[model samples]
Target: MKFTRAICIALVIVLVSSLDLTSAAVEEEIKVACVQTELIPCFVAAFIGSQPSAECCGKLKEQQSCLCGYIQNPTFGQFIKNSQNVFTASWHLEKMIIHVNLTQDNPMPLEAGRTVDLTYSVNWIPTDITFARRFDVYLDYPFFEHQIHWFSIFNSFMMVIFLTGLVSMILMRTLRNDYAKYAREDDDLESLERDVNEESGWKLVHGDVFRPPRGLVLLSAVVGTGAQLALLVLLVILMAIIGTLYVGRGAIVTTFIVCYALTSFISGYVSGGMYSRSGGKHWIKCMILTASLFPFLCFGIGFILNTIAIFYGSLAAIPFGTMVVVFVIWGFISFPLALLGTVVGRNWSGAPNNPCRVKTIPRPIPEKKWYLTPSVVSLMGGLLPFGSIFIEMYFVFTSFWNYKVYYVYGFMLLVFLILVVVTVCVTIVGTYFLLNAENYHWQWTSFFSAASTAVYVYLYSIYYYYVKTKMFGFFQTSFYFGYTLMFCLGLGILCGAVGFLGSNLFVRRIYRNIKCD
Candidate 1:
C-alpha cells in the first residue's frame, strides 16, 4: 500500500529522454584560423589542467580536420582518451576541438618533437572547442535492464499467475460451492430449515450492495485517473499507428496532451455515470470532485519536489512556461471535454440498466475450508496484467539502455494493446474476489492491485545491479536512479489506471447480473 502511494507520487514527475545527435559532415564543415605555434608534446603533464590559449582555440576551430590527427599522431598520442575515442562528431563547438592555452610566463619552450596525451573533458573553458558526433544508436546496456529499479517484469508475471489462479478458483469453485457436493437447490432442499442453515453464509448485499462507496474522494480520484489513463493509452496507440508519433521531437508529447484533453470527457462520463449508477444524487459534486482531486494531488507532489530542488538550487520547477502551457491545456481544452463526458456518461445507455437491483438472495458462501485467502486471492488477481507486458517491457528497457535505434512503432503499439488487455483482466479478477470477500467498502483495492507490479520492477532493478551495471560513483549512480525513476513512474500509472477501470466495470457487471428477488 505504501508502495502504491510512492508510485502515485512518481506519476507526476517529468521525464524527457535525450538522445545524442551529432554528425560527421557537420563536424568537418567547421574551420578555424589559429596563431600556429609549435610546442613539445612531451610536456603532457603541464597540459593536463592547462587552459586553452586563444591560438589553440583558433587553430582547433579552423583546422578541425587536423584535430583528430593531432590526437592520433604518435608524438601526441598520450592526449588521446577513451572519451576522445569516439568517431562521432558533436554539432556543439565544445566537442569538436580542444584548445591548448599558451602563455608567455610559463611558455612551453620544449624540444622540437615531444610526445603528449589527450582526452575529452568538460571541466575546460568554452573557447575554440567545436562539436562532433551525430547520433548514438549503440546497443549497450546495464542502464536499461540492470538499473531499472522498480516494476520488474518477473514479479509482475508471478503476481499475474497467482491472480489468474485465484480468478479461476473464484469463478469456477467459489461460485459452485465446492462442486455443490453437500448442497441442494432451494426448491430441491429436503426442508426450508436446511436451506436457511446453509444459506446464512455469503449472499449479495441486499441493502449495501447498492450502498454508495463511502470514500467519495477515493472513488472520484480513481475514476478521473482511470479516464485520463484510458485516453492516454488509446491516444498513444492511435498516434503510433497514424504516423503522428515518432515523426518528430515533440509529437508524442503533443499527442499525450491532446489525448489527455480529449480524455477529460471520458473521465467525466465514467465518474458521473458511476456515481449515478451507485444512486448518488450529487452528480455535479462527483464531477468536480474527480476532475479536481487527482490533478491537484499529482501536481501538488510535483510542486513539492520542485520546491525542494529550488531550495537546494537543484531545479525545482517544471519551467514556468511549461506549467503555463499545461494549465492552459487542462483548463481550456480538457475541462470542456470532461463536461461533455459527464453529460454522455449521465445519459449512458448501459448505466441505466441498474446493476445492483435488490433481487433474490445470492447463493451462500461454502462451508468447506477454502485454499485461497482473500489477500492471496486478490494479490493473485493482479498478476495477469504484468504477464502481458513481461516480454515487451524487456525490449523497451533494452532499447533505452543500448541506445538502440528503435523505430518499430508498430511493435510498441502491439505491446500497448497487450498491456491494456492484461490490465483489464487483472482488474476484473481482483474486484471480483474483493467483492466476494465482502470488502466492497475499500475502493482503492483494485488500484493497488494493478500498481503492485512496481514491486517486481524494483526487484528486477536490484537484480540488475549485481548482474548488469558497473557504474558505482555518485554522479553515475544519480543518473541511474533518475532514469529508472522515470520508468517506474510511467509503468506505475499505466498499470494502476488499468486495474482501476477493470475493477470498476467488473463490480458493476457482477452486481447487475444476479437476479433480484
Candidate 2:
C-alpha cells in the first residue's frame, strides 16, 4: 500500500513539474502585438463565416497603421500570406472592394458599418514537434459571449451552497439525536429488551448491509473502473485549473489520453483488491475486465468515428500511424501496467473487514415503501447532481457545438467540485433511507442511482441539438450525439463512483460507531 501511494504521488509531482515548465516556456516564447489583440473578433467572425461585428471592424481600422509591421512578422505573416491555409473567408456584401499589399507605404483605410465575413486560424507548434500546420479557430458569432455564463454559474453555485447547508443541518441533527438515543441505553440487557420490542432505523439491517453483495465480482470491477477514472479526471482538471493543460485543442485530448492510459494500474489495483476483499477468487478475470471494458468501448467508438471522417475526406480523421501508436499505448503499456498492479493489489492488501459479519443464511428484507424503493430513490438521487451542473452544461454545450474556445477551466473545476459534493450527499442520504427500510441491495443501486444523472445529461443534449443549436447535416448530427454518448459514459462512471464510495464509507462508519449487537 505504501509503495502504491508513493508511486501515485511521484507521478503527480512529475506531471505538475513538467506542466509548470511547459507553461513557463510557452509564455516566454510566444509574442502577440497589442493591435493584433483587436483582430481577435475578426478572426472569430472569419472562422465561423459570420459578418464581423462593428467592434471587429473598429479594431481593424485602429490596427491599420501596424498592418505592415504585422506582415513582416512570421507569426502574423503566415495568416496573411496563406489565406487558404489560415482561413476561408466568404464575402457576402452587396458592394465592397478590399485591397491587400505588404509593401504599401500608406496605412490601410477601414470604413465603419461595413460587413465582411472572415475566418481566423490559430496553430500550436509544440516545442518538441517540428511539423506545423494552420489550425482553424471555430468560435461562433459575437466572440467571447460564452464567458458571460459566469452569472448563471454564480446563481447555480449559490443555490447549491444553500441546498448543501440545509442537507447538512438535517443530517447532523438527526444523526445527533440517534446517537444520543443509542447512548442512553447504558446496559446490553436494556438495549436487547428495547431491540426485541421495536428496533428500527438503519441499525436494524446492520448484518445484511455488510453482506457481500450478489454478483460481487462485477460490482467490484465496475466500481474499480469508476474509481480509476474519477482520479484521472480530477488530476487532468487540476492541471487545467492551474492553467497548464489548456494550451491547444490537441493538448487537451493528448493529456486526457495519456493520463487515462497511465492510470490503468489504478483500475486494476482497485478492481483486484475489491474482488479479493469480496471473497472472490477470480482475481485475474476481474482485473482483465477492469482493464479492458472501458478502454475497448472508447477505442471502438473512436475507430468508428475516424473511419467515418476518413470516408468524408475530412482532415479531422486521425492518421493510421496515429491509430497504431494509440493502440500500442493501450495494448502494451496500459494493459501490462494493469496486470502488474493486479498482482501487487492481490499480494499487498489482505481482505478488508466488513462492519458486520455476513451470515451463512441471508436475512429476509421487509417490503419497502414506494418512496424508499430503489428505482424512485435512484431517480431522485441523480436530480441534485444534474441540477448542480446544468448551468455549466449550457456553456460546455455551446463550446462544443458552436466552435467556441473553452477557456473557463476555473469555472469548470468549481462545477466539478459541486457535482462531487452533491452526488455524495444525495447518495448517502438515499442509501441511509434504503438501509433503514431493510433493503441491503445497494451495490448496483448506489451505482445506478448516481449514474442516473447521465440520463438527464443526455436528455439535455437532445434538447440542445434540436432547440439551441443550428447545426445541421449528417456529419454534424453523428458527431454531436456520438461524442455526447461518450461524455455521458464517462460522467456516469465518475459520479457513480463518488456516490458509491461516499455512501459506503458513511454506512460503515455509522454502523461501526453505533452500539449494536
Ten residues in sequence with the least summed lDDT for candidate 1? 12-21
Output the lDDT of residue 408, model 2.
62
Model 1: per-residue Cα lDDT over 152-199, one tens digit each: 444444555665677667656665652253243455646655644654
What lDDT would each prediction earn against the true structure?
A: 0.51, 0.68
Candidate 1 regions off by >4 Å? 1-49, 52-207, 281-285, 292-318, 347-378, 435-443, 458-497, 504-515
Which prediction has the highest lDDT against the true structure? 2
* Cα TM-score per model: 0.59, 0.69
- Candidate topping TM-score: 2
Give the poorly placed runs of model 2, Cα more than 4 Å off: 1-148, 159-171, 180-200, 243-246
Model 1 steric clash total:
52
What's model 2's lDDT at 347? 76
Q: List the residue pairs that clash in candidate 2.
A: 46-118, 46-119, 47-119, 47-120
